[model samples]
Target chain A: MSATADAAGPGAVRFALEGRITAGTAAPIWKSATDTLVSHPNRPIVVDASKLEYVDDVGIALLFDLTRRERPPEAKVEIRDLAPNLATLIGAYDPKKFVPPAPERAHVGIIEQIGRATERQIEYAQQMLGFLGNCFKAMGLALTRRGVLRWGEVLDVATEAGANAVPIVLLIGFLMGVIIAFEIGLVAQQFGAVIFVVNGVGVAMLRELGPLMTAIVFAGRTGAAFAAQIGTQKVNEEVNAIHTFGLDPVHFLVLPRLVAATLVLPVLAVFADVIGLFGGALVMVGFDIGFVQFYYQLLGAVSMTDFLLGLAKAATFGFALAAIGCQRGLATGAGATSVGLSATSAVVTGIVVIVVIDGIFTVLTS
Target chain B: MTEPSSGTTQMSAVSVRGLRMGYGSRVLLDDASFDVARGEIMVILGGSGCGKSSLMKHMIGLYQPMAGDILIDGESIVQARGEAKAALQRKMGVMYQSGALFGSLNVLENVRFPLDQFTDLSLEQKNLTARMLLEQVEMAYAEGLMPGELSGGMLKRAGIARAMALGADILMLDEPSAGLDPITAANLDRTILSLRENLGFTFVVVTHELQSIFNIADRAIMLDPVSRSIIARGKPSELRDHATDARVRQFFNRQPDAALEQAA
Candidate 1:
């Protein structure tokens, strides 16, 4: 055993074994080794079981028992310098007993820690896909069992994600239309194509601005709300309570919000389109553009394809906001800061998903 | 109702074989094996982070074991399939360390949860059953109150009531009396014993309270926190008399044991 310790290098603790370790003598050695590891936490511990030692099954059993116990993550435990016979005996007792020590500087340096955190973030993101798949499965099961999703919960989300958001979407839609029409109409009048301003504004509002504006509103309003609600529940263990009750949390919690958002966003976008058109027409009235001609040209420019496309975009945007919101909510930790962080991240994620999906749709259909 | 198979008549309520569990590189439990007979109330005693809660979670299917299998009525939870897993889950109840009652749900609604999930009972029937369970826990008047409205003891009572709602054969409690006053906790201990005597339901409880273990547990499993594994398992008195593991001795002695002396 002494010769074996010498071979394992200087990073080992050598102990002198005086006599044959019977059933009774093994307990104290085991205690000594485990106590050393526990007391000197945050440092590598190498137990050198070298020197005149003859160990029985009891000694081997005690050593194996210590190996199975939990150690602090930062602590490194290693068995060094075992006699060949003793090593084989320990190996046969538990072949999977080998745990190499943690590398030095596992937690040292801020930059390296940040890099590790980013890797963890990426790993978590990959795991999130599996989580989403489970949620979708749970959603399907819930729908099959319940026959229909809860409209009451949907209404609550719509109120927060849509109705309450209407004022802002409307306000922004109106200002954007007025600004675009005033600028575009001035340029078009020079070419005697003032009526084309109606066409330009109408098509843009129906096909793009309406959906984009409503999605942005949802990202800020519903997205943040989702993060806050779920985050608070996560901290409070309401989510775990749901699980303990034999209900899948994904089905019970995620589906209702998903269904609600899907139904509400398209409706909100339609409202935005109307407000935007009216804003453009209001500005056109100042330029002496007849209401009758504006309505005629607007109808011509905004086709069925335009309306359908906007509606599709709305649906996609709704799911994005809901998915991002719900994901952020589920990932929340048990703190106020964690909840706030999730909420902020949810809104940011919602907007990013909305823009990326919109761009994908535009590229595909165009 | 899904009837229990006659083939499983010989099965224990929960049987763990060569079980191992850990978080990442740090092993919390290794080669731990035990069995709990039907209608037996078994309590697990351990200091903080000794894998008591983790073991309970594995037995109830909340966690997948890294090695070995936990059998719930002879079917391995680690190997159980879709409906089988759900069936296993339906047969057991868990009361978490915090009681884990839903803040969004009132006491009555929380109790009704298991009934709502697995049972075909109507809403009215569910409500009636929830009320009866609350009454048993001496909280009939508190049914309309939300979790926040209830005190700590009241919340734990409500959680226990919910755990019993499904009539599950195996009931797992993680620190059932944690954070309650002595009187309230003692009352809970009495309630547990009474339920075990009357209902013939099996219980696997993980608690740090010596009083609760002595009063309620028919058999006990004690985990050594420093080792992160079970150092002792037997009847409470047997452990008190015969635990040779220094950690186990320290645990029972409640003062410094051999390990502390060695460290000093």
Candidate 2:
């Protein structure tokens, strides 16, 4: 098929369309044809289709482009010697469709970007406050025996977030202990104070690394899972479904996870502490300290205040991770991608909160 | 309309044979068969929880059926694998219920995506073509907008534009007018008719909107979840008036009828 412009006759510029005109065929000549057609603005379109065999939507679109662009309303466009079938086919598409259109969008400057980020953070804080209030209300109901805990779900979450996480937690704790003991003992050896490394490692592990390392690992694993689960449920309207059943989503969904995490974290931290001490002792043997000497040094260096404080921090960190994960999930906006973003945000925010809480604890103790 | 099929796949654009569709142990469509003729708009009609959408998914090779063959043009999509399945898929375009456009791309980029994948056209040419298509669907004004920013009607229009970009002969639309206002729904029906009448596109639409069915369907088949098979098939008018099944009659009458129990 070919589209050629000819000034043979007066009324309007004439173009003869021959053979087939489809998306496949029209694509090769479309640029040249439309470019040639637009050059004659004042003249109307005259389509000579005496040899035309077929035309599809794209071909029809070509004719519309001719009539709609440049030509005045008073100008006349005509089709001559067209077969009845092709005539009927072209009649279905109206030429007025492409009168004019363009896409418009505003630009966001750097200042606005910063402002928007700040606004988002403020909104997040406000939402978390409300979530915290709802959590306390649910806890009050449970304590008063007005609301029953779904223990089965609590145990299931505990198994997933607690028992499944043991290996990784122990591994991190052991590595931290070994690295700290090795670094401190190497520096203290030149001063004939290698035994001080035992005291240093002992106090740090019990008071800081055990709870912090376990909580960080849990934040990445369980926090993201909680967010994804709740976010997906929110996206699928399952949260709304719970509301329709006259049950509080926070009480039914968030509380079980919160309870499970808080219950299991201290137990996991105890495992971390014992294994960490073992790892430190293994490294301490190279410093000429016997196992009994290392154990006694650790006992002298650590206090009941430090042990109980670490347990409290572990439980608090667990509560924060579960709460942030569920909050991020319940904050889901729309669509599947939104659920993914919620999960990512949950992990990131959980870690940040853990560090902030740790800093506050250090200040209060000092 | 390909002379109105007499239960044969010989002249059909899309043919489903011995199809069994369900989830796990629960069956929704069992040994179901239907034929959609060339260049005709066929509506898959059924009540909620029926297998209308599942049947469409099977045709597109998204869901594998228990036992069936979905023939697109002349190829069996159920058995076609790798490039063979993709080749058969290129002949058809599907618009999902939610207008599931790629989340990251803008409207124009979404429409141009198939062209970029399938054609060697220059970037400028592809953009112009995509714009023309968006104009055809009355969506040129929102070409820069993201899928998340669009309203329901706009999303459907942008979806139609993207579907048409590939020039697939068979277009399958699921609930095109579900959340639309009456005027917008009617406009969508008009767009469907324009495409079929002008471009000779064959359509398999899954919708229960009474107005939409009468507006565009050349033929329709009704699925009964209870029977787990198609209970009625014919031109929309004929099925509405002459179908002997009370359940079919209950649907067409649009009111509670003494002869039938509600499908849901």
Best TM-score goes to which candidate?
2
Off by over 4 Å in 2: A1-28, A34-107, A133-145, A148-153, A182-196, A238-253, A283-291, B1-11, B21-30, B106-109, B119-157, B179-181, B254-258, B261-264
Best by DockQ: 2
Measured against the true two-chain complex, the DockQ scores of the candidates, in the order shown, are 0.02, 0.21
Q: Tens digit of lDDT per residue, candidate 1, span A1-366? A: 222122223443333434444333444555555556566555555555544355433344444544444656544556566565455434543224223221243456998889989998798688678777876786677667765466677777777777777788888888878888999999998999888899889888888888998899888888899889988998789999998998776776778888778878999899888888899999999878888989988887878999989999999888778878888899886546678889999988788878889899899989
lDDT of residue A132 for candidate 2: 88
- Each candidate's lDDT (Cα)? 0.75, 0.83
Which lDDT value does model 2 have at B203?
96
Runs of candidate 1 exceeding 4 Å displacement: A1-366, B1-10, B122-124, B225-228, B256-259, B262-264
- Weakest ten-residue segment in model 2 chain A by summed lDDT: A95-104
Candidate 2 per-residue C-alpha lDDT over B1-264 given as tens digits, one digit per residue, 9 for 90 to 100: 111113545468899999998989998899988888888899999898898898899988888899989888877999999999988887788888888888778899999898888765566556666777787677877888888678888888888888887678789999999999998899899988977865678999999998899999998999999889999998888888888887777887776755465543
